[model samples]
Target: MIRFDQVSVCYDGTDRPVLRDVDLTVEEGELCLVVGRTGAGKSTLLGTINGLVPHFTGGTLAGRVTVDGRDTALHPPRELADVVGVVGQDPLAGFVTDTVEEELAYAMEQLAIPPDVMRKRVEETLDLLGLADLRHRALSELSGGQQQRVAIGSVLTAHPRVLVLDEPTSALDPTAAEEVLAAVTRLVHDLGVTVVLAEHRLERVVQYADRVVHLTGDGTVTDALPADAFRTASVAPPVVDLGRLAGWDPLPLSVRDARRAAVPLRKRLEGRPAPPARAGGAAAGPLLSARGVVVRYGDVVAVREVSLDLRAGEVTALMGRNGSGKSSLLWALHGAGPRQAGTVRFTDDGAAPGAAPAERAPAPLRGRPGRLLRGHRAEADVGRRRIGLVPQTPTDLLYLETVGAELAQARRESDGRPGLDPRGLLDRFAPGIPDGVHPRDLSEGQKLSLVLAIQLTSAPSVVLLDEPTRGLDYQAKQQLIRIIDDLAAEGRSVVISTHDVEFVAAGADRVVVMAEGDVVADGPTAGVIVASPSFAPQTAKILAPLPYLTVAQVADALAAAGSAR
Candidate 1:
C-alpha cells in the first residue's frame, strides 16, 4: 500500500541528508512501527508517506514515494487527503474547531464527502475511539489522552487508506495509550487500513506492530520482524532487554511472552531483595511545602486540598491517570497558575539565614497568590538556585531562533557565573544539537534538553519537570535518569510529573499518586508501583515476590549471587 523507492530527503541549510537511500515497502493492511533516537529523521520518514515532507516541510526529495500507487510528488497533501491521513505530534496544533464533534466532522467537510456519509462516519469514528461521551465537550476542555483520541478520530473520519501517526501515544497515560493502540490495531485487522506510526515509547506500541522499521542514527533504515529487529536495534523496551539478559532464544517483544520465558530467571532471583531505592536515605528537611492547596478552572476544581512536602534531597514522582491534577499541582507550586486557596512556603533550609520566607500568600477563595515563587538567593549562594520548573510544553520557554542563540542567552542570563556555560550543560544532558539548528527544529527530546539546560543555569535547589521523558528514546531516558540522580545528589529536591511507569521505577525514590485532585497514595517506589497493576513495570509484574523493578537490577543481583557462590 505504501512504497518508497530510493528515497532520500535533505532540508535546506543542512549538508547531511536526514534520510538517505531509504527504500522500503508497507504491504496492504499492515502496521509498521518506526523507531529511532531523537532527530533521527523518523518524522521525515512519516511525512514522506502523505507527501508532507517535500511539499509542506520545504525539503528536497531524491526518489519517488507512492501511496496506493499514487506518486506523492504529483499529488500534494490536500490532493492526497482522501488516500492519506496524517496526525502530528501535537494534536492541538492541528485542531481547527473548538468542540470534539466539530473537530471530527471538519475533516470530512474538507474532503467534501456527502453529508449523510460524513454524519454516519463521524458517529462510527466516535464509537470506535470511545469518544461518544465526550462528543459535546470542547476540545480545549478534554484531557491530553482525550485530545489524542479526538485527533485520531478526526483523521479516521476521512476513511483514508493509509494512516500516518507521529508519536500518537506520547502524551497519553498507559490505559489511554492502550485504548488508542487497540483502535489502531482494529483498523489494521478489522478494516484493512495501512498504518505507519512513529513513537519513542517503544514498550507501549511494539507489541501492536506487525513489522518494525529501525532508523539507525546515521541516515539508514533496517526493516525486520519485531524480534529480529530488536536484537541489534539501539533502542528497545525493558522487556526486550530482559529477554536479552536472560539469553532467550528469541527476544520477547511483549510482557506476556517475557514473563513466560522468565521462569528460570525468576527462580534465580527468588530469595534476592530488590535493589535499594536510589533515594533510600532520609532527607534533612522539607524544601517546599504546600498546605491545603486548591486550584480551580471556572467551575471545576482541578486540585483539591492537596498537602505535600518536597524534601531537600530526594526524587519524587507525581503519577496518576490523565486529568488527575498533576499538572495543576506542579503549576501551583511553581506559582505560575491560580492557587485559589493555598499556602506555599519555602523553609529556611531552602532560604538564606537572614532572608525572609518566600511565600505564596493566599488571597480570597477565588484569588491567586500575591507573588511568584523565585529561587532563594541563599540557595543560590550555596551554588544552587532555589527552584526551577520545566512545564509540560517545553517550547513555551523557548524563543530564540538558533540553538546557539538560545544557549548564549541562557549564559548571559546567568550573569557570568563561574562555571555555568549553556553549551557545557547541554553536552551533559543532551548532546549532538548543532549550533545553527532552530529551537523548533530540534526533536522533542533535544528541545527538552535545551530548556533543561537553560533552567539549570540558575542552579536551582528544586526542579519540577512535567513529562520530561515524553519524546526521549531509551538511551536518552537513561541519560535523564542520571541527570535526575545528580540533582538529588546535590541536595536538591526533584519532582517529575509523568505517566511513564518504567521511568518512575528506574529513577524515582518516592511515588505520589493523585486522583480526583487529591493525594491518594504516596510511598517508596517499590511499594507504590508494585501494588498497582496498572502502574507497575514489566519486571515487577513478572517477578512479583522478588520486588525487582528493572532488568538491570535483576542482572546485578544474579552477578553478585554468582560471585558469592
Candidate 2:
C-alpha cells in the first residue's frame, strides 16, 4: 500500500543524495524488511512514507511517494498521521508523555479516537507488548528496551494502516524481541496491517519478514522475496550463512529448516571440537572488586546484595531479560550508580593515563540507596579516569556539533596523551565519517561508534559498554569483536551489557546473566548460553548438542575435520 516513483532524497549540507533514483512498492499486508549497511539511506527512505523527509527534515524530494492511496508529497506528517505510525531509532527522543500508559493513549487522543476505543486499544497494547507491570512507571525511569516497547505501543494504539519501525528490537532481549515481532506478525496476518521495518539485528527479524528491501549504500533499493533477497544479501543472518556454508539447495530460511539440513553436517563434525579459545582473563586477579552491592530506586530494589569481580584481560557479556538489573549492576561496579551498602576495592596498575598509583585511591561508591555507565569516565580520585562507560543511549554523552569536534573534545579531556587519541580510534571503529557533519545527524550505528571512540579515548583500565551492539550491523559488529579482542589482549578489563546473543556468542569470553536483581548464571560463553533456551543464538539452536555458538565456528570445525561431504 506504499509506492515510490523515481524517488531521490538529498539533505542539506550533504554532497550526494541519500536515496538515488529509487523505485519501490510495499504491497498491502506485506511485512517488508529494510536491510543495509550502517550509513545507507534506510532511515531516510522510511521517513518519506509519512512525509518527514523534505517536509520536516529539510532537504529535497524529487519524486512521488504515496501511502494507502494518499500522496506523501502533498501531505505533512500530521496529515498522514492517521494512515502511518512511526517508531524511530531513539524511542526516548519521541516520547512526549510522562508514563507508559499515558504515552500509549497520547497518539489516539490526537487522532480524536473515541475515549472507549482508546481505553480498549491501550489495554490491548499493554498486554501485547508486556507493559502491564510497567504501566505506571515514569518513561524516564524505564530501561531503554521498555521505552522502545512504549513507543511501539503508542503507535499501535492509533490503529494506523501502515507501521514504520526503525530498529524496533535493538534494545530488547532475545525473548522480548521475539514477542514484539510475533505481535507485529499477528497484526499483518490477522488485521492486514502493512509493516515496513528496518533493523540491524537480522537474525531476530529475518525469519518473520515476508519481503526484503535491501538499501545499497549507493542509494538504490532492491526488493525481492525473503529467499531471493537473502541468497544475494550482503549481510545475512546466521541461519542463512549456515545454509550457504553447507551448500544446501534452496537455502534454508529458518532454524527449523537449517536444522533439518544440518544432519549430514552434524555427522561430518561429530568428533570435531569447537575452535580453540583464548586465554580468558589470563588467570589474573580482580581488576575491580564489588561486594554486597545494592541499588534502590524509591521502594524498588533495582539491585539486591550482589557481588561480582572483573578480572583483567577478560571480555564479560552481561545478559538477562529487560529490567533484570544488568545495567544497574554495571553502574554499581563502576562506582557511578548508587550503592546502598557495599565495599568496592580496586587495584589497577594502569588506573588512568599519567596518574601515579599512590594518588589513585580506590574511592567507594555512594552509601545512599538509588541508582545509575557508558561514557567517557572521570573519577574523583586520581583524576586518572580509571573506568570508562558507554551507556545504552550513547547520544546523551555527545554534545558537540560535529564528529570531529567530539573527537577533539575527547582528546582535550584526556590531555591528548598517547593511546588517548580519539581520532585514531574512531577511524578504526567507523572510517570515513565527515569532520563537519553534526553528530546528531549521523546514523544510529555511526553515533554508537563515535561514542565508543570517545569513551575508549581515556585508555581506562576497565571499559563498560551497555548495549553497544544496538545500532551496529553484522560487519560493524565483527569490527567491534576485533576491538573487544584487542582490548582484552592489552590486559584491560571489559564488561558489555547486551541482549545480542549472537554477539555474545561470537565475541564474549564469559557470560554473566542477571534476573530479578540477582546473578542467576555466570560461566563460559557456550556453557551459559547453550544451556539456557531463552538466550541461545540461532546457530546454537540449529546445532544443538554441538556447543557451536557461531556459524563461522561451525565452518572452521568442518574445515579442520577435512570433511569431503
Candidate 3:
C-alpha cells in the first residue's frame, strides 16, 4: 500500500534528517507494527506515508514515498486522505469537530461525498466503533478512551484503504485499549484494510501484528517475520519471553498458545503444590496517608470516601479497568484535582520529632515532614518538587531539544540539593539513547525511559508513574521492572497506576484495585491479584502460583522446585 525509497526526511529547524536512508514497503492488507526506543523516527516513518513528514512539517525529503502509486511529495495530506487515514497518539489534539457524529461525518464531507453516502458511512462507522450511544455527545464530554475511539471512527469513516495509527491506544485504559486494538485487528483481519501502527503496548497488540518493523536510534529499519522480529527487536511480548524460556522456535503470541507450549513443563511438574504467599514480613507504618478523600468533576463524582496508606520502601500497584477512577485518585492525592474533604499525611515512621498534621494549610506542608526522609510524596505542593509524575501522555512533558537537556531541566528544577549529576543518573536509568537528539524523535519505549530519567532525577522518595510499562516490549518491560525494583530498594515509595496485571503481580509489593471511583481491593501484591474477581492471574502463576508477578519469578520457582525435588 505504501513504499519508501531511499527516504531521508530532514525538518526545517534541524540539520540532521529525522529518518535517513529508510527503505521500506507495506503490502495491501498487511498489519505492520513499527517500534523503537523514543526519538528513533518511528513516527517520522509513519508521517512520511501520508505526506505529513516533509510536506506538512516543512521538511526536506531526499527520497521518494509512494502511497498506492501516488508520490507523497506530490500529494499532500488532503490528497492522501482518500487513500490513508492517520490517527495520532493524542486523540483530543486531532479532533476538529464538537460532536462524535459530526467528527465522523466531517472527513466524508471534506472528501465531497454525497449526503446520503456520508450518512450511511457515518452510521456504519458509529455502529462499527460502538459509538452509537455517544453519537450526540460532545468531544469534551468523552473520556480519553471514548475520544480515542471517536478519533479512530472519524478516520475509518473516510473508508481509506490504508490505516496508519500512531500510538492509537496510548491514552486509553486497559479494557478500552483492548477494544480499540481489537477493532483495528478486525479491520485488517476481516475487512482487509492495511494497518500500520506505532504503539508502546506490545504485549496486547503483538499477537495481532503480522509483521514487526524494528527501527534504531540511527533511523535504520529492518523487516522481521513476527517471531524473528520480536526475538531480535528491542522488546517482545510476555508470551515471547515465556517461549524463549521454554525453548520454543516460534514464540507463541497468545496465552492459549503459551499454555500448549508449557504442557511438557507442566507434565514434568506432576502437580506440585503452589507456593505460599510472601506477606509474612510485617509492613511498616504509612509513608503517605489519605483519609476520607472526595473529589468531583462538575456533577460527576470521580473519587468518593477513598482512603489508603502507602508504606515506606515499597512499591504499590494501583490497578483498575478503564475509567475506574485510578487516574482521578492519583490526581486527587497529587493536588491536581480538588478534594472536597480529605487529609494526606506523609511522615517517616522512624523520624524524630514528627509534627502534627497540618489541616488544610498547604500541599507543601503535608509533604514537608516527610521531605527529610523521602524527597517527595504525592501530597506535596507542586513547587516543592516532592513528587515526580510521569503523566499518562508522556508527550505532554517533552518540549526539549535533547534527551540530556530534558533530564538536566528536571535535575535543575527538582528539590534535590546541589551537585546532582543528571547526565550520570540518566545514563544509569535510560542508558541507550544518543546524547544530542531531541526527545520527540525517539521511539515509544525510548521516550518512556527518557521521561522516567527526568521524573526520577530529583531522587524523590515517592514516585508516581502512570502506566510506565504500557507500551514497552518484553525487554523494555523487564528493564523498567528492574529500574523500579532498584528504586524500591533505595527506600523510595513508588506508586504505579497500570492495567497490566502481570506487572502488578510480578513487580509491586502491594496492589490497589479500583473500580467505579472506589478501591475494591488492596493488600499484598499476590493476595490482591489472586483475590480480584475481575483479574485473572497470568497462566504461569495460575499453573504455579508464585509470590512474584513476573516470568523471572516463575523461573526462580521452577529452579527452586527442581532443587527441592
Candidate 4:
C-alpha cells in the first residue's frame, strides 16, 4: 500500500539529508510502526507518504514515494487526500471545524462525497472511535485525548486506503492512549486499513504494531518483525528491556509474554525487598507548599482544594487521566495558572532562613513567600523567580524566531541572576541543535528541550515539567531522567506532570495520581504505581505482585544477591 524507493530528504538550511536513501514498503492492511530518536526524520518520512516533505514543507526530495499505487511526488497532499489520511502529533492544530461531528464530516465534504454517505461514515466513525458522546462537543472544549480521537476520526471518515499517524498518542494519558491505539488496531484488524505510525512511546503502541520501521539515527532505515527489530535495536520498550535484563532467549514484546517468561526471575526476586523509599530526606519541610488550591474554568473545576508539599530533593510525578488537573495543579504551584482560591508559598525549607510566610508578598523566585496568583497576572515584587514552569505546550514559552535568539534571550534574562548557563543547559538538554534553526521548526521533542533549557536558566528552586517526554524517544528520555536526577541532586524540587508511566517509573521519586480534580493517591513511586494496574509501568506489570518498578532495580537486586552469595 505504501512504498519508498531510494528516498532521501534534505531541507534547505541543514547540511545532511533527514532521510538517507531510505527504501521501505508497507503491505496492505499492515500496521507499520516507525521508531527513531527526536529529529531523526520520522516526521519527514511520514510526510513523504502524502507528499508533504518537499511539496509542502519545501525540502529537497530525491527518489520516489508511492501510496496506494499513486506517486506522492506527482500528487500533492490535496490530490492524494482521498487515498491517504494523516494525523499529526497535535490534533487541535489540525481541526478545521467547531464540533466533533462536523470535523469528522469535513474531510468527506472536501472530497465531495455524497451527503448521505458522509453522514453514514460520520456515524460509523463516531461509533468506531467511541466519539459518539463527543459528536456535538466543541473541538476546543475536548481534552487532549478527545481532540486526538476527533482528529483521527476526521481522517478516518474519508475512508482512505492508507492512514498515516505521526505520534498519535504522544500527548495522551495511558488510558486514553490505550483507547486511541485500540481504535487504530480495530481499523487494522477489523477493517483491514493500512496504518503507518511514528511514535516515541514504544511501550504504548509497539504491542499493536504488525511491523517495526526503525530509523537508525544515522538516517538509514531497518524493517523487520517487532521481535527481530527490537532484538538489537537501539530503542526497545520496557518489556523488551526487561527480557534482555533477565537474559530471556527471545525478548518479549508485551507484558504477558514477559510475565510468562519471568517465572524463574520472579522466584529469584521473591524474597528480595524493593529499594527503600526516599521520603526520609523529603521530610525536612517542603521547599514549596500549597493549601486549598482551587482552579476553575467557567464552571469546570480543574484542581480541587488540594494541599501538597514539595520537598527540595524530591522528583514528584503528577499523573492522572487526560484533563485530570495535573497540569492545572502544576501551574497553580508555579504561580502561573488561574487559581480561584489557594495559597502557594515557599516555606522555610532550610533553603531560606527565619522567614515567615509572606502571603501577600511576591513569587517564590526571590525566596520570598508569595501566595498563588488568583488569575493570569504573575506575582508582583518577585525576587529571584524561584519556581520555574515548563507548560504543557513548550511553544508557549518561546516566541523568538531562532534557537540562538531564544537562548540569547534566556541568557539576558538570567544575566545577573544566579543561574545555570542557557547555552550549556541547551546542550545538555538536547545537543546538536543548530543555532540558526527556527524554534518553530524544531521537532516537538527538540522544542521541549529548548524550553527546558530556557526555564532552567533561572535556576528556580522548583522545576515543573508537564508532559516533558511527549515526543522524546527512550534516548532523549534517558537524558531527561538524568536531568531530573541532577536537579534533585542539587536540592531543587522537580514536579513532572506526565502520562508516560514508563518515564515516571524510571525517573520519579514519588507518584501523585489525580482524578477529577482531586489527588486520588500520593506516595513513594513503587508503592503508589505498583498497586494500580492503570498507572504501573511494563516492568512492574511483568514482575507482578512484586514491587520491582524498573529493570535497573531488578538488576541491582540480583547483582547484590549474587555478591552476597
- Which has the better lDDT: candidate 1, or candidate 3? 1
Tens-digit lDDT track for model 3 on 172-214?
A: 6556667778878888988889999987667667878888898
Candidate 1 residues 342-409, lDDT tens each? 77767745344433222322111111134221233333333234566787668877777899988886
lDDT of 2 at 515: 90
Per-residue lDDT over 1-565 for candidate 4, one digit per residue giving the tens place of the 0 to 100 score:
8889999988889888889988898999999999977878788888899998888889889998988889988899999998889998778678888999889989888999999999999998888777887788788866666788788889888888899999988778877778778888888998889999999889888889899999887889999999899888888888888888888978788888888999999999998997642322443458888889999887778899999999888899989887788877886776645788977778744335433233343343211124333232343224235677776667767777899998887776665577777778777766789999998888888888888888788777778888888778887887778877777877888999888888888888888999999999999888888888888888888888887887778878889999999
lDDT of each: 0.82, 0.83, 0.71, 0.81
Worst 10 residues of 4 by lDDT: 365-374
lDDT of 4 at 226: 92
Looking at model 1, which ten-residue stretch has the lowest summed lDDT?
360-369
Q: Could you tell which candidate, 1 or 2, scores higher by TM-score?
A: 2
The Cα error of candidate 3 at residue 14, in Å, is 7.6
Q: Which segments of candidate 3 are over 4 A away from where they belong?
A: 10-20, 115-127, 130-138, 216-218, 269-282, 347-385, 395-405, 415-421, 432-448, 470-473, 530-548, 558-565
Worst lDDT window (10 residues) for model 3?
A: 365-374
Error of 2 at 262 (Å): 1.0
Q: What is the lDDT, from 0 to 100, of the residue 101 in candidate 2?
A: 91
Q: Looking at candidate 4, what is the lDDT of residue 242?
A: 80
Mark the regions of model 2 whose C-alpha exceeds 4 Å error after superposition: 277-283, 350-384, 563-565
TM-score for candidate 3:
0.84
Query: Per-candidate TM vs. native?
Result: 0.93, 0.94, 0.84, 0.92
